[model samples]
Target: MAAWFLYREGHLFPCYFYQTTGFYCLGCGGSRAVLALMHGNFTDALRYNAFVILLLPFLAYFLLSMLIETICGRRILRRPKLPGWAWICFALVAAAFTILRNLPFMPRL
Candidate 1:
């Protein structure tokens, strides 16, 4: 449904952070990336937002695991508990991606 809306409407919403700061946020181009992925355009999706592309699998796994556990009253897969350092690393990666995507030398995300 979201992909359909994006297909019909072009863009879902402007990134207020980017608009105000003239800098791409971590979520910049995320919607377009999703739309591109839905259309089976892997390269375009990655170009739109490499961070989102790379993270989607983990996000999908987490959500699917949660849903499965909720519905079945047991986990189909073991839920891996991320340590504090892992979260910090993830945050650092996000910050780096945000900065890199906005760099003049980098391709537009």
Candidate 2:
């Protein structure tokens, strides 16, 4: 419903980080990407925010796993504790994506 409203409104609230820093942050275009995904427009969603599109499945899985565990009182999926190096790698990938998306030749996301 919120995605529908946002789509109908034709504008998303501007990203404060983008406004101040003149660069796309890791979360830039995330709302629009979600809206596009909700509408089943995978290409547009990826265009709006590839990072969000790529990460959403894992996020959804974890959320759903938690919900199921709460309802059934049994942990079906063991939540893995991410090691420090995994976190560091994730950060590096995010930083790289941020840089790549901000390149002049790249489309604004």
Question: Could you tally the backbone clashes for each prediction?
Answer: 0, 0
Model 2 misplaced regions, further than 4 Å: 1-12
After superposition, which runs of candidate 1 have C-alpha atoms over 4 Å from their true positions? 1-4
lDDT value for model 1: 0.88
What are the per-residue Cα lDDT tens digits for candidate 2 across 1-109? 6557788874568899999999999999888898888788999999999998899989988989899999999999878899999999999999999999989999775
RMSD of each: 1.8, 2.2
TM per candidate comes to: 0.86, 0.82
lDDT of each: 0.88, 0.88
Best by lDDT: 2
lDDT of 1 by residue, 18-80 (tens): 989988999889889888888889999888888888989998999899999999999897789
